[model samples]
Target: MSNYCIDIFEFGRHKTQEVTIGDVKMGASNPIVVQSMTTTNTNETEETVAQIKTIIDAGGQMVRMTTQGQREAKNLEHIKAQLVKEGYNQPLVADIHYNPNAANIAALHIEKVRINPGNFVDGAKKFENIDYTNESYLEELEQVKKKLIPLLNICKQNKTAIRIGTNHGSLSDRIMSRYGDTPQGMVEACMEFLRICKDEKFFNIVLSIKASNARIMVHTVRLLVQKMNEEDMYFPLHLGVTEAGEGEDGRIRSAVGIGTLLMDGIGDTIRVSLTENPEKEIPVANQIIDYINTKEGHDAIKKVDTDNYSPFKYTRHQTNAVKNIGGNNVPVVIGNNHFTKDSDYSYIADSSVIVSADKKEYPVVKYSNSNEFDFNNHELCFVKIAYSDMDDSAIQFFKQQNNVVILLTSNNSNSTIEQRAAFLHLRNHHVTTPVVIHKLYDSVFDANTQIQASCDIGPLFIDGFGDGIFIENNTENQSLVINTMFAVLQASRVRFSRPDYISCPGCGRTLFGLQDTTVLVKEKTAHLKGLKIAVMGCIVNGPGEMADADYGYVGSGPGKVTLYHQREVVKKNINQEDAIGELVALIKENGDWVEPS
Candidate 1:
């Protein structure tokens, strides 16, 4: 669109030809795009090609494979050749860093090259980690630019679409030396790179400013978009929360971070970074797109609506409903999932109140750590809970809460034993509390039996639960449950346990005792509530992951360590002999650590 973003985000105003990669296109005028990064090693051509085919078969239109070195780059042509031979004509992107030559090479076969300027530029030599208040800072800045111009040109001439990616790692040492590794510093550095690309006549570009911090990630995107808008610019923004772990938390955090931005209409493309297989990312990424553009009669978004009902739009109205539900003291079980105490549950606790129940009157209870159900002093206390669709009492309980609860139950509620058991749970629970019974696509025969026996007679329910309140009823697609739950939790006043761990998957290169350090750190800090700490391996992704954490310890060499707090390096070159004690002491100094036992 605007000239301000002409180079960094060219919308092709004159032509607006859909920018297709393989078959996926993401542009101002193009339809919503879904993409994923290959988890296969670039050097493994057979495995990589196999994975790419699987991705395409699974509905991925655009894919990215890493090209970390010349070997991988050399192998990339074969990888492309193989894909072409196999008739796998999807758009592929080469994720290359540091080596500009690699970028030039990758551009030969891949549809795009994702360049991290922070890593590509040579750090100013004269400006070594010293305070700029000293001298030589301005001179160093001039020298840094002198070095980066050539690489920028090489990319421009290749007709490559540069993904201006800014990460905590590979930060231009000059920026780190001046601003430290903070979100603002990262965003500013990325913008500067975009400015450079524009100056060098590189107009085909996509932009991403990523961080591991869920909060920071969301905020940075918001700020970047705001800044771009102020300057009257529009570019396709890639969304991701890096180092966002595997399994439950990773998915939840990515959904929260990416979902928050998409809701604000800030993201154009997205990648769900996980430590697991890249194929898993495709389904999650697609669901996010579907969730955002949910509307009646929208087929593409609706296809993933496994529940047969139109996808639910997360709007201000649902938020208002949560607010309305929070004003009650009735324990609300929103779904059939087990309620685990001390896990900071989002679905099954009354979060409206913060104080102890002993001090309050009837219907008052201690709020779950999640704080998802904040209530007024006089409002009815309702603790919302959820379970699988096969739990009948859980499903029945849905009706009592005005069907506000999420019901994940079997589609056949009365055909068999499992279905009947589920029906009983929903039927019984619906008599008193708010419950919404979501039907499962699978056979509920066995599942219903399990739920009936488990919940109906358990000590927690032996005394029998009571019907409490009823709110509203709507069946949600299971594919979007995780995203919807997170969306709902965010709308509520949910709380999360802080000072989490970010450990690496040990590889051959892993050294400096990552396993012991991680275990020791977690054991030492176990009781330290609300303090985020990371024990990471070599400086590669460690610093970035640690930036998202409150504090971190990273290995540089045998018996050498670097400590970071609040994303800024506080200590360097500490001997391994004193590393543990020193790190613990530093953490204690910040008063974020639980007293060491």
Candidate 2:
């Protein structure tokens, strides 16, 4: 049994207790739920209801709205009445933070209430470290539980399911003091409340552990399940990458985080958190669901021999250096046709390599379970082996071979996991051959292709499996194949050919034009390669939300913005029109700014 997955080799959904929210049921073999949160103000009943309809039409199985205080909490009654009046009976969930009374009011009026474990009775995040003795920590946990039990009781009485969501950026000062914003800290922050729920006999619970970084989001969710297993907790997971910005970047980021877990049979519900309209997020979530559904009944993957792998740690499997392809090199992206350095070129067989075969310039050997290669003569060679055809003999053939790189391909419906298992086998056998992940998509390069490639190849890079990627897709031009590969590599955090952006999907609390502002920030900063910039809707989770970003643009109020250099506030409450220039000035002052090429 794997800590991250129910069974690392077996392809199936992670079994969890069913949580009923009004008419919708989630987890435990239920259709993986698709969900989105509204950006419309909750008090505007008409607008909220209309947006809910649009979200449902766009395939949102459940809709969530922000309820910050008594005003928004009470307004839900009118919203619910309006939705029911229009013959729309979809379940409604209230997103609660920093208010227990709002959660109690929401529990009585809505189908579900989500409480941030970081805020519910926990000390506010001052980002200060408090060295807590064991006695002090336990006492604080007890006090927090005593305060939360009342909300759990209200939820139980109302038959309302509760989701304890742990956002990476919003971890409280107490939790962060000891665990320091890590995967273990995220799990424990959620678990303290879950333990209270258990003690109070409140069983209807769903859980979420999210981050802006796609790789961290995946790692924490995997670790959450592992920790839950140890504690006998099987709460359903709500998978998402918080603040995943709009357009293809948002889609690719969501896929890399959510798709990686879904491949391992984790996640009960998913939301593609985009900075655009909430309704636009549903179709992207649907695409990820449809793509992952294709992995269910594939040919079984062979069980790995010895798993010396750590789910919490990211250590690229060791391999011999093959030029710029592997061994501490950033993972390369390869196109089917000849391309530049980052976009490397590859040959499928000897027929195409015939011209270069004599010179052994870039020759490849197709393994038919035998090796007749002139290793002594060639300085370097790429050995291709069907991942499905690999066994002890194949591993033994390449175990001690020098000047060799492995090209892995698979036809199994198991998708990425099949290739993953092959990587494990090589690692177990002490093979240091650099590996390149290869996939052939029969369809043209489109939205599906972008999502599918990020899902398949991105995870390998996130988990440190493949040394390079070679993608073959039916497209009219080479740009489709080459462009998509670089995007996947960038999303995977294995390489960066563009500026990385993190922007939150705005909620009712957001008081500015988040979508347009995010676009503006991206347009201005897109040329800063390797720089991470965050465009957040509001300060509630903004300053903390950017994670490792070098700069942040946070909406502090209507027509106002705040600029941050990492976590320190550089400028507070500047006019929206002046924010971009001030941000650029801050970047330049910090020695991070470079002129656009």
Candidate 3:
């Protein structure tokens, strides 16, 4: 219930007001819960029930299913009955959008109901910009209250908890008109519904503000927590990064967003939205939760003055730029190369390379295992210090050089903590030389490599630690290694090199073929470096969820699309067949189009 964010060094979980859904208790002193959603059509009771069973059996503490309309809402009864018959009593959540009636019916059979405030009452298709006076807005609130009362009564009668979830991609036109699609808008959107719940004396509620962009997600959740504190409301928070794509990109994106908040002691329950089978998401969620809960040395790291930092916002810490490592330059990516007689330096082009001392490289940073390395090449030399090597002598050596960047390494199981503690030691000792975070993996950088690296290194970046990232692995594919490094940088918002698509993972509410449309959009626009294009599933969160995207292609209706320049709708209801072409044309018109090489 405290307003202050958790101290990164304290390792304390924030205690929230407990909300019970069935036998599952979340928030308060409960172990952080893991949850996932089924991708099958909710109306197909058999398919949904089977998926839910898989999710629960795969270690999901709770399972969610989309309930978009009357039929899906009604089918919840059958899903619950089948689940019970199969001896699975895990709590079920109904994910509702654009329909209060569905929520009303879902509450009767499910343990909890999730309503997107953006479209629960306001239709997603009606996206006209509205000029509202204070009086007019109050009138609109009155209408919303009327529409929500039936669902509220049903939830109260059934003892069902509710999550007044707000998606960054989806905000009502009124909220957009007033708040201009910001974190502020996201907080206010949830507050409007929370106010209604309070008026009805319904207190069993959770809150979430999700965004595809991790930076926005972190900012919004912090703001929501602060706002809730101001209002004396203590609701548990449900955290996730929506539409995090498949594979390593999805996992890293989800972890950077969700893990950042978890490190701050902010979430009660979490779901990692990977575009894979619902069951695939559970283990990743579990890994993140287990890592955070068991992560040691938060208390061991010496705390530095945070007067210059705000937990609710991001401002890159100012440090003297050492060559290409820091200062106003975007953070650099250092590719790890084994020092060998026949080592290929071709992959090291355009990137600062890390090589061992025996290699005798001039342009590359010479990595030495001991502190006895020559510091004469201060600008290009990096000394590798294991956690065991961290002592008064090592600290003094690093402090004395003042120009050689420190390459901190660890072989301990909790390497992230050890590596971070080294950084804390440097900062605390006022050793301002730039530091490149290095994590060595014994195996190849494959499918699981990104997850491990992100978990180990992403948090350090989120907390404003590294100057460059050096990943050491045996993966022969240089492009994959380089791309993954940059991806982590982009996901952390420390650097940007490619187009960031804020594409939503398709759901029942998706109006168009989300997967195909996202592919088409990427093909045409992925060359526009650093430009963010949101390929949303539907209009519900399309405009709002685009967050700070440079352009948007959101599904408006069946085979219909709406294109946006920034957050403003420039083209509405275009045929899906031509939407991509038109989006490209619009980009060309705006001078953002670049010919793909």
Candidate 4:
């Protein structure tokens, strides 16, 4: 059994039992695989087949389709037939929730079946709170085992692999009554089903514990690894952050969660769930996997006081709050630019300034390499220091200035490694000044900039190392850089400047139009800063997946939507036409609504 902690600094991949799905294999010396799901209805065999082809052509090794009922389950045969006829032998995974019979049908036709353990036997929309004793909880597990045995036999007979995926939002009433919606509860939910699979002598199993919150997602996955090792079980893990909204926000969230685990050598296969087309997700997943592969054994930073820190849990390191940074304050974002006489500073207001030494704009922070700069006007000064130029004088100067924040840059080939090592040097010398991670890139492509910046800056935040982030890219789109900065912060759960939308990537079970409805929800509620609003496609992922959303807009049926106020159903089955208006009225009824300026 592997006995390694999930710490990124001490790198070692946890060896796992490799399971093959169709022609593709994952775990144990295999390269990390990329997967995506189709947003089309499963009954539309032609459209489903077309999307699968598009995903495969765009670099997805495996494709998944939703199966919510008997018809969708039966249609998997036709979908598989069409793909084989089109000369594609890519593996097809059936995504099942709340239907054991559908899972049985899917197992016979597909290469793999992904069942949500929280809802495989229990129905969604039946979230009743029950107080169960220990004996009663064991009885519930026994009942679940009876319902799950048939599907396990079918999968075994057909050589079908099983993914016992547990979502953070959808924990069963029994788990909630005991564990109260936590990472421990998530791990227990998966272990319950895994035990049944083991008892049935079915070993072809994969596991996933997903959450929209990156902190929860990271913690739960790490806890699951520890528990599995204790039990001598080595199932490959599929990593993702669910309902991570569209565009740069989605990419950054996926990277912060998935990239962090991958740095610790965790995750076998991954899927980046976005609110856009399925094909658009492939490139982002590839970028994350490719970047992690390059930094497998490279020593990025020197180890500090990690003995007091738990790699399986998150605990922010304590520091004195200098102005609006450190201690209880959220990590800040600093922008790097050379201000000119005609430059417009009004467009960017949220970011703290990081102007050059010669500029006289009186920025909140100044960046310079020389020790003779004027530090009287600014409350915070970021003295730029390269690793190669560090000496006794530089160290002494940093110790003398009470208002100085180190701006670490690199001239070495591996800038990430150099900058991180510089932070360790300060810690070793007892330098307590706060450090802002500054990375400069020459890439003109927006995707490259996002990936590189996230890889460099994400792990530092995850490790409780940085106080703020400053990114300088050569692209002409300034808004892209600004948005990416906040995206990284939001993903890290350090700060929130705008509304957070918990939108599920669409599937066959989605009622009404998901993409269009998401756009309308954002149009109306994006102004509510710091408010977490969930726009779910169906009830199966609605109440549970919207785990911590303050408000919810969930699809109940065709042209019918349900609005939720923190898990309680406030309005049930309202017309989809008037749902947005009612959601606004409900927000106003509470004290959360604000007028857009």
Structural similarity to truth (TM-score) of each candidate: 0.59, 0.96, 0.83, 0.89
Inter-residue clash pairs, candidate 2? none
Runs of candidate 4 with Cα error greater than 4 angstroms are 1-7, 10-12, 125-127, 297-301, 338-379, 385-401, 409-431
- Say which candidate scores most in lDDT: 2
* Local accuracy of candidate 4 as per-residue lDDT tens digits, 1-597: 224354434555667889988888888778888999998999999999999999999999999999988899999999999999999999999999888999999999989999987888766636677889889989989989988999989988899999999999888888888888889999999999998888888989889999998878888898898888888898999999999888777888899889878876888999999988989999999999888777755544444443344555666555556565566777766554533332222112245455432443333433343545667656765566676666777777777777776767764444555565566666667677777677777768387668767766776676566777777765567667767777787787777878888898888878788888888999998889889999998887789877679999999898899999998899999999999999999999999999997
Arrange candidates by lDDT, descending.
2, 4, 3, 1
Candidate 2: regions farther than 4 A off: 338-342, 346-351, 354-361, 369-373
lDDT of each: 0.52, 0.84, 0.77, 0.80
List the candidate numbers ranked by TM-score, top first. Answer: 2, 4, 3, 1
* Weakest ten-residue segment in model 1 by summed lDDT: 310-319
Question: What's model 1's lDDT at 161?
Answer: 64
Winner on TM-score (2 vs 3) = 2
Error of 2 at 382 (Å): 1.6
TM-score of 4: 0.89
Screening candidate 3 with a backbone cut-off below 3 angstroms (N, C-alpha, C), the clashing residue pairs are 168-545, 169-541, 169-545, 170-541
Candidate 2 vs candidate 3: the lDDT winner is: 2
